[model samples]
Structures are given as C-alpha cells and as structure tokens.
Target: MKLVDVGGRTMAYHRAGAGPALVFLHGGWSDGRAWGPQLAGLSDGFDVIAWDAPGCGGSDDPPREMTMADYADAVAALVAELGVEAAHLCGISWGGGLALAVWQHHPELVRSLILVGAYAGWKGSLPPEEVEARVRRLLAEAERPPAEWMDAYLPTFFAGAPPAGSLELVRSMMLDSRPGGLVPMLTAFADADLNAVLPTIAVPTLLLWGEHDDRSPVGTVAQALRSAIPAAELVVLPGVGHEVNLEAPEAFTTEVRRFLQAAGATLIRVSRATCALCGQQAASEDVPLTWMTSVEDGRKRLYCDRCARENVRSIEGKLDPVYW
Candidate 1:
C-alpha cells in the first residue's frame, strides 16, 4: 500500500507485480480492491497498481467541488510519483471514462489504454428519464439481497451468459461500496463528455464492450468512438456485459496483454524517430499529431520548435535509419 497526496487529498493505492507498469481503475460502486482477480492474475508479468478513488476505500474525499479532470490529474500525479514515464492503463465502467480523461490530458504518459464498457458522453440515445430511472433503481436496491440484484443487474452488464461466481463477487463489491463515493461519482458520470477530447488521445487504445451492456450499449457508442479515434481497436465479447472484466477475467486479461505487448513494441520503434527539438518521436499515423501537421505530400511534417526552426524535416531523411 502507498499514499499519494494529490489536490490536498491523500489517495490510497496498492501495488504488486514486478514488470511493466499497469494501472487498473475500478468502476463506480467499487474501490481499487475490487480488482483482486486481475491483480492476482497479472501480477506475475506486470507491475499492477490500483488506487481507491476519492471517498472510496482508504482514500479521503475531494474538496466540496471536483471535476473529472481533477480525478484525471490525481492519476497523473500518482503515475509521476511512482516514477513511471508511461504505463498501460485499464479502466472499467466509470473508471473507463476516467482513464479516457487521463489519456486525453496526458497522452504522453500512457503507453496503451483499455476501456471496458465506457462512454464518451452522457447524452446517448437512451432518454434521460430512462437512464435516471435505471440508475435510481440500482442505487435504491443496492442494499438488498445479492442474488436478487445479480439476477436483475447482471444482465445489463454482460452478454448472452454470465460467468460463474461473477454475480456473488460483484454483489459483494457493490454492497461494500461507499455511498458517499458512489453519489458524487454518479453525478460526475451524468455530466461527463469526452467527445471533444477523444480525438486528442494519441496512444493506442483498445475499447472492449460486452455485447449486452445496457448502461452504455456497445454498437453506436463503440462504433462512434472507433471512428473518432484513429488508433482505436474495438472488441465485443460475445457473452459478456458491462462488467466484462469481472465476468470473464481470462478473456479480458488475454486481450489486454496482447494489446499492451503490441503497443510497447510500437513505442520502441517510434522512439528512434525522436524530434531534435522536443526529444519526442515524430508523429505517425499511430500517434496523434500534437505538435506536427500532415502536409500535402502524403507525409507527416515535423513541427517541433527546434526541427521547424531548421525547416520541416522530410520523412525521407528520417526513414533511412529505421529504428526497428
């Protein structure tokens, strides 16, 4: 366990594993501890870090007012404090939104991103009233029997079938959640809009969705995000739901491992194309053109202050010495 003081609040985080850094962000109605299965499964091959959001588990609440960016900043601070220049990020449900927010604000710090049952905005095709009603009902009956809620709520998150023991574990995590944390988090969810920021994320992203996710359905939202982000890959789990990570840990972990491995390898290749001025790689189609521009010659023109002062460097000059 470690503590990171960000925004005047002490955030609690648990760390495990011994390889490449990987951070897991839990969804609403759950704390970092909810990732027990994943932490155990992946710890052998990766450095796993999971933290409790403000007002959840061992973390202190944020000041009276807080925004999604605040949460994203907190994560950035934690990543920096850990001395990690970049890491593979995974977020579930509400945490998925936070992960996207983090990537939007600090793409350079993320090696790869995974979003499970996440949304870009709150204003989807579902009517506001219907959305509110479902949320209200879930919150209202959260304290009741585990089996009952599982029977009712589990379907909305998974696909054609639920995994064994998933219902019980999810029920326990929900019941243990802090209402104080859940309420504010839910309020934030109601107002979240990553549509504008989505295009800005340059890191490789894997968008995972359960075929039957009612809260944030897969088809339209997932398709729209895939279209919006140039480097995003979408995967639909056949018999899963909103809590696909929890329901099918093996499948989810496998997909995440594959994506991270590929992203890491690509990062190695791009590192050799470092810009003379900023010491960062030349922007490629796989990466966003944050400080560069695409010219009419079907090539990415370098726009680094140092490189630009000397005139935009041609790709032909840089291509001779391929890094990979």
Candidate 2:
C-alpha cells in the first residue's frame, strides 16, 4: 500500500514479485487493490505492480476537465518513478485503453500490452448507436447515488452470478470511488478513439475477453483490437463476464502468464536478496514490500516484510518455504 507522487497527486500502488515488472491497470469500477488475484498469481515470477489510477482508489482525483491522455501521463510518471525502464502493461476495461495510451505516447516504457475486456474507447471500437447507448447509460447512472449506481452497474459487469461476495466487493470498491472523478473519467474515455494507434503499436499484444462479456463483447471491441494490432493474440474464456480478472482469475492468470512467458517478455530479474533466517511460511523479500520470494529452491530468497522482523529462526532448515 505504498503511495507515489505523480503530478502533485498521491498514487497508491501494490508492488511484489522478483522478475520483470508487470504493471496492472484496473478497470473503471475497481482500483489497483482489485488486482489481488493478479498481484498474487503473477508475483511468483514477475514484478507485479497495480496502480490505483488517477480518480480511483487512494489516488488523487483528476481536475474537473481532463482527457484520457492525462490518465496516460500519470501512468507513465508512475512507471518512471518505480525506476522501471520498460514493463509489461496489463489493463482491463478502461485501464486497457490507458495501457494503449501509454504505448501510444510513451512507447519506450512499455515492453508489451495485455488488454482484457478492453475497448478503443466506446467511440473508437463501437458503432455510433452502441456508443450513444453507453453514453446515455453512464450519464443516467452518474445521477444516481453511489449505492444505486453500483447496484445498477454491477449486473452489467457479469453475465450471470459470479463468485460469492464478488458483487459486494465490487460494490464496496465503487463506493470508495468519488462520483465527480468517475463522471469525468467516464466522459474522458467515452470520447477517446485510439483506433489509429492500434495498428501502429510495435510491441507484442495480448487481448483477453470473457465469452459472455455482454458489456464489451468480443465482436465489436475485442475483434477490432485483434484485427488492428499486428500479430496480437486473443483469448476468450467461456462462462466468464466483463470483469475477466475477478470473475475468473485462474483462467485470466493462466492466459497472461502463458502469453507473456511465450513472448519472452517475462524475463526474471536476475537479482536476489538475503536476510536473517525467519520462521516457516518463509516468504523472502527481494525488494522489500515488493517481493516475498520462496527460498525452497536455490534462488536465494529474502524475507517478506511480515516474516523479516521475527526473531525466531530454523537452525535445521526443517521449516522450509515449501511447508507453506
């Protein structure tokens, strides 16, 4: 839960893992903390960082008027602050467009792109009628109270019932968001059309969508992304919905890990950390709050923040990392 200063605003982020950096851009409803599954799943071998984008989570809200480009700039600033020259940008929904914008403006900072349930912005990916429909729906929702807004918005995020408590979790996250920011953020993205940038992107791109994603179905947005991006890979998970990562994390995790690994994009950071012996659950920290790597293997692992300060140690090496 560390915060970085980006453009005079505090941007909250989660950092973990021991390999090439994977920066996650969350959808509109959920912020960086929503990437719990990804932060855990990918951190095993990749440096995973999820940002509470501007106007969401603990980050500062954008001014009354700001475009999608402004969001992109904040992302670029965060990446630079993290000292990462280049990283794999993974975004879902609105975050996907933000990721594209990052590649659009700051190409050097992105090694690859992974978009889930993404759009070129409504204007860029959908027909005129569909775009209009979304605008009206969003505008109407903006007028409602947070609880009502979330109640109305939540159903569209899924095809049917999702995991227990998922709906509630999303509701809580949405409520935590500021209405003023959400409206402007919505307006900013709705008008954005990065269709032209899709074909021009040189990095490897992976597009993931839920088969039953009615919100941003595969045909319109997903198909357009696949067709426009050169040699991009597209995967559709059956029974899943628009919130691909949350609704089906295991599947989403598998696709991303496989895609990045195959493209040779997830090069493990050839660095290690050593620390005083700690108790079992032997999670080691390589980059302090950024990683809690396992020491079961030969890769010298450091202590995770939690296990680091403990005075107890295993003299017999019997309390190995694998026990956890």
**TM-score to native of every candidate shown:** 0.76, 0.79
Worst 10 residues of 2 by lDDT: 315-324
The residue-by-residue lDDT of candidate 2 on 117-156, one tens digit each, is 9989878877879878877877787677677667777778
Q: Positional deviation of 236 in candidate 2, in angstroms?
A: 0.7
What TM-score would candidate 1 get against the native?
0.76
Q: Tell me the tens digit of each residue's lDDT in model 1 across 1-324.
A: 578776577888888998999999888767887677788888999999998888777888765466788788788888787888668899988888888878766655576788888877454324578658756875775456534554465556556554677666667766666556766676666667787666545557889988777777777777787777656789998777788887788888888888877877553223223442455765453432223323433333324456554645344333222231
Scored by TM-score, the top model is: 2
In terms of lDDT, the poorest run of 10 residues in model 1 is 315-324
lDDT of 1 at 160: 54
lDDT (Cα, 0-100) at 152 in candidate 2: 74
User: What is the number of residue pairs that collide in model 1?
Assistant: 5
* Pairs clashing within candidate 1: 157-241, 157-242, 158-240, 158-241, 159-240
Candidate 1 segments whose C-alpha is farther than 4 A from its true place = 1-8, 124-152, 160-165, 267-324
